[model samples]
Target: MLIGVPKEIKTHEYRVGMTPASVREAVHHGHEVLVETGAGAGIGAHDDAYRAAGARIARDAAEVFANAEMIVKVKEPQANERAMLREGQILFTYLHLAPDPDQTRDLLKAGVVAIAYETVTAPDGSLPLLAPMSQVAGRMSVQAAAHCLEKEQGGMGILPGGVPGVKPARFCIIGGGVVGENAAAMAIGLGADVVIIEKSVPRMQQLHRIFGHAVNTVYSTRLTIEEEVLAADVVICGVLIPGAAAPKLISRDMVRRMKPGSVIVDVAIDQGGCAETSMPTTHAEPTYVVDDVVHYCVANMPGAVARTSTYALNNATLPHILAIADKGWRQALAEDEHLLHGLNVAYGHITHEAVARSLNMPWTDPHTFVRD
Candidate 1:
């Protein structure tokens, strides 16, 4: 098997699919690795490093895409990259397809076997592949919000942790999952008053035990979200629905009611966001003002810290990559139920139920084609 790594071409997406260490492991497993020239530049690994790791560097993405049996990428294929996909070729990457109809259509047209990292699940129902970036983005959300809260950035000039005699800023996190938990830790560590609104009683109780008197855990509801969001200085929306689009818990009216110059960082923007006003933004211009409230909705917040994100992601994805390379995708999926959940589209058909339902497309069970 030949695994190809192409440089990410998304707006300000600087992470690469495979690190030299990942390539070396694949090489050790007797798989050939092809990396497009400068693919690892974002993470500061040059061609020489990949070459030293037994990877051949292609002159361009076209050559790599044309030759490799499996394309390993950090982000989903862009329009041009999607056009180059061949039938039966494997695309193992983060395909946030529930919100992106065009990408789903393109994958179907290309007849490629698309395996999304974000959709893979662990035995305990945790998202193992998506956890590293969730941690990265969750930590970054507060940093972004703190910057957005500066007066020059259209915020209320409120510091996240106030000085002596001044009250600290209030932060409302809309989920208690990995993203919300990491955000709460960061916010609380910075001396900000934090409240986490979650629906799960067990999870909320765990959060209560984790934070004790430091953080407030409230049962999530329409009234609670509205009240908490309106009163908060910064609201971090970290809600997720696996491979489906994120539920819009914060309405436009709720945004309108928030205090003037407050910040809302929709960390769920990758899954189409949890706010009605949330639109994908880039690190170049990461914020927009609506109803006089600051909204930071960068779709790839982890991408801004490419080196850290790339290493963390490769750590989680390498074993799966090795599995696909050594056993082939069919055998790999057949052997690992968790990996089979990653299959979204294969041979012009949608294979993931959540993605199919979200896009209003028919889905064939992945197991049916695993033996085909």
Candidate 2:
């Protein structure tokens, strides 16, 4: 099997699909690795490093896409990259197809076998591939909010951890999953008053046991969401519905009533956002003022720390990538039901039910493609 690693081309996305270490592993597995020239520049890895790792460096994406059986990428294929895709080529990446109709259309037209990292599941029903970046994004959300809290950034000019005479800023985190838990950890570390709104009773109890008096846990309700978001200085929206679009828990009217210059970091922006007013922003211009509320909705927050994100993401994705390379996608996916869940589109058909439903497209069962 020949695998291609392309440099990510999304707006402000600096993470590459495979590191030199990953290439070395693939080579050791009897798979040929082709990396685009300067593919690892974002993570400070040079083409020579890939060469040293037994990877052949290609001059451009066209060569990589044309020759490799599987294309490994950090982000979804851009328009140019999508145009380069060929029939039956495997695209293993984070394709958030729910909110992007253009991308969904292009992948279907290309007849590519697309596997979405976020849709892959573990034995425990956790999203293993998505967890690394979620952990990064969840922790980064607090850092972004902290910066947004300053007056110059359109925030309330309050400090997250206030001085001796002033009170610390308050934080309201929606959802108590991976993102919300990490956000609470960061906010609490800074001595900020933190409240996590969760719907799961067992998870809420777990959080209470973990943080005790350091953080407040609340049951999620329309009334609690309204009251808590309106009162908090920083509101982090981290709710997610997996391969489906994120639910809009915070309405535009709700945002309009937030304190003047308050901040919102919508960590769920990748799956669309939990706020009605939430729109994707970029790292170049990460924030915008909305009804006197500051919104930080960068779709790829982990890209801001490319090195850490790349390594962490590679750790989670490498095993799955190797499986596809060693045994072919069909055999590997047929063997592992969890991996089958990652197959969103194949042979000009939508394989993932959630993604097809989200896009209002005809659904094709994934098993049809997995011939044992």
RMSD of each: 0.8, 0.8
Clashing pairs in 1: none
* Steric clash pairs (candidate 2): none
Instruction: State the TM-score for model 1.
Output: 0.99
List model 2 lDDT by residue over 1-372, tens digit each. 999998788888889999999999999999999999989999999999999999999999999999999999989899999999999999999999999989999999999999999999999999999999989999999999999999999999998988898999999999999999999999999989999999999999999998999989999999999999999999999998878989899999999999999999999988889999999999999999999999999999999999999999999999999999999999999999999999999989999999888889899999998875
Span of 10 residues, lowest total lDDT, candidate 1: 363-372
Scored against the true structure, residue 168 in model 2 reaches a CA lDDT of 99
Q: Write the per-residue lDDT of candidate 1 for residues 316-347, one digit (tens) a residue.
A: 99999999999999999999999999999999
After best superposition, candidate 1 residue 92: deviation in angstroms? 0.3
**Shift in Å, residue 283, candidate 1:** 0.8
Candidate 2 all-Cα RMSD: 0.8
lDDT of each model, Cα atoms only? 0.95, 0.94
